[model samples]
Target: MTTGNDTARTTVVVVTWRGREHVTACLDAVAGQTRAHRILVVDNASDDGTAALLAAHPSRPAVTRLGTNLGYAGGLAAALPDVGTEFVAWLNDDAVPAPDWLALLEDALDKDQGAAAASARMETAGGEPISLGVTLTADGHGADTTDTGTETTGVFGFCGGAALLRTEALRRVGGVPAEFFCYYEDTDTSWRLRLGGWTVLPVPDARVVHRHGASSRPGSREFHRWNERNRLYMLIRCAPAGVAARECARFAALTAVLPLRRLAGRNLPPAWNFRTGLRVQVLTEVLTRLIPLTRQRRAITARAVVPRPVVWSSANPPR
Candidate 1:
């Protein structure tokens, strides 16, 4: 979806790494967007010759090749300042969006003056439903909500994998958290935008087909470690004042308990690899930055106009 700018109001950014098989189709689909938009590809040092492939394409999108992989969020963040558009749309190289995907999200954001972002309905390429939108629990556990034919603007956050972001709003909060590097960065950004008094919404009619974990191999030790650790950072860095104490206690307790529980079969998930050292690392990561996170909390506390409860509520308002 486009926001009606004379010279491409939105810059569609696709981040890729050794994604030669998938990037071609993804680029073609992006070129077919119903609305006019610019395209950019940030290559995270793909040895697969993804750059050569892009160079030969008719679209000839501007490409930035990095020396080493910067994970998903880092690659995109690196390209943000030069985006030069009112909005930015992210497409996972593993996902291909429907032609109207950008248009629908653009329309939703245009109509909602306070909304900072809008996400497309995503499903797997095999037609399995992924997420219609999102909502979060009191403890910062995010859940994907399937489309129920009654979808609305409310959502916990846009999955960074595919979504439209308001450029100015994104820059105001210092862009995505690079410390997260990859996983949970979007969740942390969502909390920051909400706390900055902007709503993150969903365009349920806008659709995309995502090949889940195509770039980052699922269940990889690196993936799981970052997954658990970043989730902790997300809650600690942005959980509201009311939810902070409980969320922190739960996070700290789990950081300690996940390792210990692996000692007993009845309490452990079979796949648990017993990374006791990684668990300790996650526990201390936040405590090391207590001063900075507290400063962030204060800024969010003072700027937050929307009550945390209202921003988090899942109850559908009467339509």
Candidate 2:
């Protein structure tokens, strides 16, 4: 199959799972880019006819259909090897970008030689801003800069949903952390990029309207489990030791007091028990992986070009 954009230097990778209703429109918007970029669709084992639809697209995007759902992190990991382009843009199946989305982000990277990634301004369908970029909290959590009410000028991280990244930079950072399965992977990568002396920039003019959580509902138990577990895991792999330790201890304290709070009627019993059980699972998983996680921490520390304090301070400038 002729994977269109033969002369283009960038490929937009859209990862989808059971998103038949959204994938077509997503691909159509990408194929309509004002910039001459290629389209590559990574179908994460979607059983909802998404793969077939991609195969039949007039744009004839290169499609990789995996046998099992590997989530967004794994899909990107699998597709990276075939990117061949100098840059790769990641777009969610539920997002539709303006015609110049890629062009503007490409211009941002072109203008900023030191930047390894550029985040596009993403808004909800109703035009409310969702994220221009991500900012790191002291406790190892990454929040949208828009949500933090902070300056959006130079963000520390880019949202995985709509962003452009240098292909070489991505490979240098050891690629996406497939172990994450989904959440916090981008923040973890951003941390690595900063530690490697690279910056993530925001391209406010490049915009996309995202139907947030279209594939995975935000409040579901699955979402909570992955979000919490991966947040801690990201801290272990990337955050400074002091921050990691403090956050881990805080998580433990929360887990310990949850049952008492449930008994006191501070938290609804059913929800409380479920929350407590998941926290136990997260703690157990982290404990079992401590040895490997520590080794990763050491490896990151050894290669880091920026000071830990500087990295943390950039995200948390004195207000």
Q: Where in model 2 is the C-alpha error above 4 Å?
A: 147-152, 268-274
Give candidate 1 regions above 4 Å deviation.
1-6, 255-267, 272-275, 307-319
Q: What TM-score fits each model?
A: 0.87, 0.94
Give the per-residue lDDT of model 2 (tens digit) for 57-96: 8888888889999999999898899888889988999999
- Across 239-315, the per-residue lDDT of candidate 1 in tens digits comes to 65556667667766776777557666446544322466666666677678677777766666666766655655533
Candidate 1's TM-score reads 0.87
Worst 10 residues of 1 by lDDT: 310-319
User: Which predicted model would earn the best TM-score?
Assistant: 2
Write out the backbone clash pairs for model 2. Answer: none
In angstroms, give how far residue 37 of model 1 lies from its true place: 0.5
Shift of residue 40 alpha carbon in model 2, Å: 1.5
Judged by lDDT, which candidate is best?
Answer: 2
